[model samples]
Target: MSLTTDLAQAKSRANIRAKARAKSGSETTPAGEASPSPRSRRRKHRERIYQWLFLVPAVIYMALFFGYPVVKNIVMSFQDYTTATFFTGEAPWVGLANYAKVLSSSLFSTSLVNTALFTLGSIAGQFVIGLALAIFFQRKFPLNGILRSLLLLPWLLPLIVSSAVWRWILDKDSGALNRFLGGLHIVDTGIPWLTSTSLALIAVVGVNIWIGIPFNLTILYGGLQEIPDELYEAGSLDGATGWKAFRHITWPMLRPVVSVVLVLGVVYTLKVLDIILGLTNGGPANSTQTIATQSYDLSFHEFKFGEGAALGNVLVVISLVFAVLYLRASRRSVDE
Candidate 1:
């Protein structure tokens, strides 16, 4: 009886000691891991802060470079900012006056039409030719890699260089194009490609199309390469070959990439300035004058900084709408 009682007392004392120790010690995680110490937690937080320090420079750079300019442009759009304002620092508030003036101008209408034509022509020509070339290169040929690399030359050249080269090529007199045409006896007189009002915009669009071809080719080719051969083989079994195969298997699969390419092309084409500036300078009665070039002229030449900002914002709004569309397309692609 006494031994049994002593054993019970000993067990009770052990239980009491264990409970005391549990109360004094740190809590544990669900997996029975002891909680981290305060000092260790502080050290971990400090380490995380050190990791975030790497992004500080990028944040600052974006703020100073892109964010500040966009905000300043928006503010300037609402004020009568000009060369005079620059020196005197007295840009009077003008609300929507700048926008009303720019939008009502006949030049704005001409520029808007030109922008539409330039964008459409460039995108259409670039996409069609690029797709055709991409399909051709898909087949095996001698020096295929070399030729493909060389094809990128136009796109790889700097815009300024391309503009200068095209300027010489398109020069009505003593130009390579005119010389070639003369050799073929196509025309007795050289065609005024840049100097003529009717032809200058067309010529600008052609140059932009040429510059944009290789980019479309490269991207579309990559998209084509990603398509599974198994799909094509299966498609063939179903009597879908050649044109039919492309129409069904290839076209359906390539839609997402096509959407992305078209949107990006439109955005890029809208902002083109250097090529037009170098080739025509929006000359011959503002034939090649686009919103981009007009904005440049307004800000620098006419000293209408507020109007320039307003025009620039219009471009920005247009780009943002396309950007949203791109995001939705991208999301749909991901969902698929």
Candidate 2:
């Protein structure tokens, strides 16, 4: 009788356990729904972690290199960071005094104007010539590869080296350019290309254009190649050849690449220091003094680190504005 009672209690406990499991199943997954297994859930979590793991190196790199320098520069901009600070290890906070001093100076206006002119002229010349070259090279021809490779020489050469070569070429005396012009009877005497205030900036812009052309050509050519030939073939069937095809199809397709090239060219041209310093050293009465050169002068030459940091920050702000504008424009274009 006792054994029979124990069996009955055991059966009742099993029924309670089975009913609890059924209730939990209904509550958790409901009917017609399948719940994820623990193995699948863990696998998904592992996949997410793996994805983040791939990004860790890039995050750490940017933090250590780009982030720290930017933060340090910004902090230094507001302080009297100078040679004295190095010895004493004290950079006193001076609020906006550095910015005021930099902005109020007469040289700042000249540098700003020069920077604008240099950027605009270099970009315009580089884009126009580079696009022409890219289009010309798109056609199959003999020696095309060789010529393209040769064209990159100017860009591959160091900026200082290029500047030195250009300086010799543009020298007021015994220069290749003057001699060539004299031979052609274009001018009677040696032109002081670098010495003259009016001509110094022009010469620098021309050299920058020469150096930048190869980069523009390579990028634009790649973009051109990506365009399908079938589109051109179809357009030709519709009497869209030459200018008509370019205006209707090529221009529309190349617009995105052109925008990229222009923005990058502008940003690069803005902070051009080596070329200017190598060519003119912001001389001829500070005619070629750009913001970049000015910042270099302040920090290294004058030992005014705070003012230099301020100018550097200003340039960064300008670049950021252009980048933001490009992003907005790109978004709008995508939406449309």
lDDT of each: 0.89, 0.90
Record all residue pairs in model 1 with backbone atoms less than 3 Å apart, i.e. clashing: none
Which candidate leads in TM-score?
2
Error at 32, model 2, angstroms: 7.2
Runs of candidate 1 with Cα error greater than 4 angstroms are 1-59
Per-candidate TM-score against the hidden true structure: 0.83, 0.88
Worst-scoring 10-residue span by lDDT in model 2: 1-10
lDDT of 2 by residue, 62-97 (tens): 789899999999999999998989999899999999
The digit string of per-residue lDDT tens for model 1 on 1-336 reads: 443454455556656757865876655434533677788789868755754464465567678988999999999999999788978999999999999999999999999999999999999999999998888898899999999999899988999999999999999998899999999999899999999999999999999999999999999998898899999999999999999998999989889989989999999999999999999999989989999999999998999999999999998998888889999999889768
What TM-score, to 2 decimals, does candidate 1 have? 0.83
Q: Model 2: clashing residue pairs? A: none
lDDT of 2 at 320: 88
